[model samples]
Target: MRADIDGLPVRELTGLEYASIVEGVSVDGEQSPIMHACGHDVHISALLGATRLLAEHRERWSGTFLALFQPAEERAGGARKMVDDGLDVRIPAPDVAFSQHVMATPAGNVHACLGPSFSTADSIKVTVFGRGGHGSMPHTTVDPAVLASMIVLRLQTVVSRETRPGEFAVVTVGKMTVGSKVNIISDRAELQLNVRTSTSTPGPAC
Candidate 1:
């Protein structure tokens, strides 16, 4: 199963405000501009506070609240998968859902989307298979290592050559695995990629 919350740092409780007081530790860390830093802790704190308020003021609203702490945004499609896995059936699906991300937008201000909320994403893997052989042999077998390397470079052109400029898309080859030994060429090579888009456009989804 996909993780509940995606893109969030591992320290889940770090986002809570009273966590520091309860745990008797400091929440703030050294500041860095281009780093994994933000006011997410405070925002998460406010969310918790809101939940507390709702629980306390149970009669204030006559509806049930499903406060979801989701995961796997960095991997993409987790939200949709959650919905598919009876998230709506087990809990309650709303006409619309909302989410907020820190560090994507500027500070000192809150951002919201109206129509098209955010980009969609898909993950894919490409495997190239060939015959393995000793390093000293040249024509004895097909070298998938070479072919996979070539495919890796060729994939780069997919975004540049195949995809037009400003098409709001990305194709990234994140992993490549070939042979295990130095003297023997591998029989197969694999490539893992994550693609992103700002619309319903679909590529090869893993």
Candidate 2:
């Protein structure tokens, strides 16, 4: 068995005092605050529980068990690192292994089954460009606020309307910032989008 001891690079906005006290992540020369937004803590806790229970009941079973707690799952490959570090020789190579996860749901329940449950994560940062001018002048400049709104709306249809039914995919526009003041027309807008999917879909045309 294996559990991921990793977290995502997200700002902790829970308003709780015990939130992430550390700074964010640095990727490709960019930095952002980080948190355990992906429920990796719960996974690690479960792994500890299982290890303790089995250790206390060693007389009940005759089979071998291997528990692997790994880090850097959010990056490229943590498992490969484990293997290269002599995991196979340090522990008995078992025939099968399993892992579980906790996802955000209304019920807040835990479920487990065969097959794939998690999706690949792909994120992008985009800066929408437009012309800036006075707010009172309607025809003098291109309004990026309106254009950005349209782009956000159209991104929703990428998974819902274009992708085939029963396919697993999600496109989320998590952040957007535009304009400076009420009377100033902003020239640009910034957006952060995260994608999870098993297939690709068409993007909106600007």
The lDDT, on a scale of 0 to 1, for candidate 1 is 0.66
Candidate 1: TM-score?
0.63
Tens-digit lDDT track for model 2 on 1-206? 78898867778788898788566546645576767667786788788998999999999987877778888886647888988999879987567755456766565576765777778888788898999999999589998888889999999998779777777888999879899799999999988898898645544443
What TM-scores do the predictions have?
Answer: 0.63, 0.58
Q: Write the per-residue lDDT of candidate 1 for residues 17-111, one digit (tens) a residue.
A: 53432222222342312212235344555567678898899887887776665444455566877788878788754777655545466657877
- lDDT of candidates 1 onward, in order: 0.66, 0.80
Over 4 Å off, model 2: 1-37, 47-97, 103-110, 200-206
**C-alpha RMSD for every candidate:** 8.9, 6.4
Best candidate (score: lDDT): 2
Best model number under TM-score: 1
Q: After superposition, how far is residue 167 of candidate 1 from its true place, in Å?
A: 1.5
